[model samples]
Target: MMSNQNSVQSGFLPIPSIRRTVSPSQALSRSLATALVLALLIFVLGPLVVLVLWAFAGEWFYPSLIPQKFSLSWWSTVLSDSHFGHSVLLSFIFAPVVTILSACICLPAAYAFSRYQFPGRRAMFIGIFATNAFPKMGLYIAIAGILYATHLMDTFWGVIVIQLMNTVVVMTWIPAAAFSAVPKSLEEAARDVGAGPFRTFWHVTLPMARPGIIVAMIQAFLASFDEAQGTFLVGAPNYITMPVQMYSMVTNYPQQAAAVYSILLSMPSLILLLLIRKYIVGGYLAAGFRMK
Candidate 1:
C-alpha cells in the first residue's frame, strides 16, 4: 500500500527539464551576427547622428562628444521658408501622381509579361532595366534635353514624366514576378463559374497579388520622393520638389538646414512604412523573397 501510494505521488511529481547549451559553431555564428549588426548600425547612424547634432547645435566645434549649445533657430528658419513649404507640397502632389501613373503603365505591361510568352520578352525586360544602367547624370542630361525640346521644362507634368524613369521598370518587374507566382488554375476556376476576364482578375487574381502591388507602389513613391538629380535638372528654377530643394540646401545652407530637410524628407516615408508594415512584410513573403 505504501509502495503504491509512493508510486502515485511520484506519478504526480514534475520532471526537471534539461537546458540546452549552445554549440561552439552556433556561439561563433551568433557573435559574428551581433558584431555585423552593430557595425552596420554604427556605419549608417554615425553620420545621421552628426547631422542631428549640427541641426540643433549653436557653436559646435572639434573635440566635443556633445554639442556646446543647442538651439531651435535652425528649425524656426526652415519652418519659415516658403520655398521649403512649396517643395514639400510639390512632393506630396508629385509622389502620388507618379505612383498612380506608374501603376497604370506597369500593371498592364506586367500582366502581359506574366500571362503571355513572346519573342524578345526577356530582351525587352533587359532593355527596360538597361535604361537605369547608365550613370544617372548622363541619363538625366539626356532626359532633360528631351524635356527642353518638348517645351515641358520646369513644368509639373515634365517632372512627372521624368519620375516615370524611376518607377516603371522596377514596378513592372516585381508585379510580373508576383503574377507569375499566382496559380493559373484559380483564374480558370473563376471563369468556370461564369466570371469574365476582368471580373476574374478583379475578384481573384488582384486580391492574391495585392501585397506585391502595394509594395511596388510604395517603392515607386519612395523613388520619386528621393529623386534629386533628375528633378533638379528637369524642373529647376520653377518647380522644385523636396529632394531637389534639399540637395540645393545641403550645398549652400548651414548643416542645420540640411538636417531639417533630411527629417522632413524622411518623415513621410517612415510614417508610411509604419502604417503599411504588414503589407510590406506580406509582399516580401508572397513574392517568396527573403527579408534579409
Candidate 2:
C-alpha cells in the first residue's frame, strides 16, 4: 500500500515539475521578444536621435557619443535673422501651393485610371512610371531651357510648375488606390436611387476617398517643401526656398544650418505623419474593399 502511495505522490510531483519547467521557457520567450523590439527601435530611431543631438551640439566633429556642451545659440541666430524668416515663409507658401496644384491635376486623372477601362491605360501608367527612372539632374538643362523660352525661368511660377509635374505623379497614385477601393455596388445603389452619375460620384465616391486624398496631399506638400535640386536649379537670385537657404548657410554656419533648418524642415512632415498615420494604414488595408 505504501509503495502504491509513493507512486501516486511521484506522479503528482512530476506534474508540478512540468509546470515549473514551462515557466522558464515562457520567461525566456518574453525576454527574447523584448530584446527584438528594442533592437528594431534602435535601428529605426538611432539616426534621428543622432541627428537631433548633432543639431544641438556646439560643434559637429565626431569622436564623442554625446556632445560636450549644448546651447540654443544657433536657434536664436536663425530666428533673429530676417533671411531665415523669409525662407520659412516661402516654404510654407509654396508647399501648400504644390499640394493644391497636385490635387487638382491628379484627382480627375486618378478617377479615370481607377474607374474606366481606357485603350492605353496600362501603357500610360508605364510611361508615367518610367519618368521616375531618369535622374532629376539629367532633365535640369532641358527644363531650364524650356522655362527660359517660356519666360518662366528664375521665377516662383517656374519652380511651382516644375515641382507640380513631379508631385502629381505621387499624388495620383495614392488617390487612385483610394478611389479603386470604393465599392462599385455603392455607385450602382446610388444610381438605382435616381442619382445621376455626377451626383453619385460627388456623394458616394469622394467621401470614401478622403483619407487617401489627405495622405496624398501631405506627401506632395513634403515633396515640395524639402525639394533641393529642382528649387536650386530653377529658382534664381532672389527666389529662395528653405532648402536653398539651408544649403547656402552650410558654408558659413554649418552648425546653425543643421540646428535650425533641419529641425524646421522636419516639422511639417512630422506633424502630418503623426496626424495621418492611422488613415494611411487604414487606406492600405481597406484597398480590397472595392472588390466588394
Candidate 3:
C-alpha cells in the first residue's frame, strides 16, 4: 500500500489507453448526415441566391454562371411604386392587430388548458389543432362563402378575421405549454404574502411565462403577415397585404418586384428572430413537460 501510494504520488498509475474504431454503419451514417446537410443548404439557399441575382440583373439570359450586367434600377422602381407602399402599410398595420387580438383570446384559454382539469378539455385542445391539420386553401374556400354571406368580404375587419384563424391555434398552443411550465408553488408563495388570485397570476406567473408569450406573439404576427391563401381569397382586388402582392408580382413575372417584396416580407421576421434567439432554445421549450 505504501509503495502503491508512492507510485501514485510519482504519477505512475497504469491507465489503459483505448482506441475505438468507427463501425461501418456509423461511418455510413456520418457520410449520409454530411450529404443531407449540404443538400438542405443548397435546396433552401439556392433560390434565395437566385432571387438576389435576379433582383439586380439588368439582362441575364440563360446558360450564364453570373448576370451579364447589374444595376440599382429595380430597387428604385420598386421603392417608387405606390401600390407596393400600400401593401407594406397594410401588412404592418394588420399583422400586429391580429397578433394582439389572438393573444388576448388565447391568454385566458391557455391558462385554463394549463391549470384546469375540466370536462372535454382534451377534446377541445385536440379540436383546436385539428383546424390546422387540414389543407388551409380548402378551409379558406369554405370560409369565403361565410364571409360573403356576412358582408365581410373585401373589408378590413374581414381580412383581419381571416388572418386571425391562422394564428389562434399557434398562439394558444405555445402559451399553454409556457403557462404549464410555471410553478404553482410560486403562485402560492405570492398569495401567501396576501396577493389575490388575479394579482398573484399577474405579478408572478405572467412574468415567468413572458418569454414564451413574446415568442408566441412574434410567431402569430409572422403567420398573419405571411398568410397568402386566406388573405388573397378574402381581401384581394380590394385590400392587398404584402404576401398577396408578392404572389401577384410572381404570377405576373415581374422578377425584381417579386424579389423586393420577398425581401420586405422576410426581413422583419428575420430581425425578430435574431432579437429573440436566446429565448428560443430547445431547453426552454422542453421545460413545458418537465413538471416540478
Q: List, residue by residue over 1-292, the lDDT tens digit for candidate 2.
A: 9879866876779886576669999999999999999999999989888878867877655687888887677787777889888888988988899888888888898888899998988777656665566677777767899999999988989999877867766676778888888999999999999999999999999999888888788878888988888888899676788888877777777664566667877787899889989986775534522321
Q: Report lDDT (Cα) of residue 94, candidate 2.
A: 88
Please tell me which predicted candidate would have the highest TM-score against the true structure. Answer: 3
> On residues 1-292, what C-alpha lDDT tens digit does candidate 3 reach at each position?
9877766655643342111134666778999999999999999999999988888888777899778999778888888889888999999999999999998898799889999999999888887877788789998888899999999999999999899998877788778888888989999899999999999988999998898888778878889988888999999889998888887788885677677667767898889878778877744445433322
Model 1 residue 119 CA deviation in Å: 4.4
lDDT of 1 by residue, 129-210 (tens): 7766888889888888888899999998888988888897668877887787689999999999999999999999888877
Per-residue error at 266 for model 2, in Å? 1.1
Segments of candidate 3 deviating more than 4 angstroms: 1-33, 283-292
Best by lDDT: 3
Query: Least lDDT summed over 10 consecutive residues: which range in candidate 2?
Result: 283-292
Give the poorly placed runs of model 2, Cα more than 4 Å off.
Answer: 1-35, 58-64, 283-292
For each predicted model, how many residue pairs clash, with residues at least 3 apart or on different chains?
0, 0, 0
Instruction: Please give the lDDT score at residue 102 for candidate 3.
Output: 95
Question: How large an RMSD does model 3 have?
Answer: 6.3
* List of clashing residue pairs for candidate 2: none
Among all windows of ten consecutive residues in candidate 3, which has the lowest summed lDDT?
Answer: 13-22
List TM-scores for all candidates, in order: 0.83, 0.82, 0.86
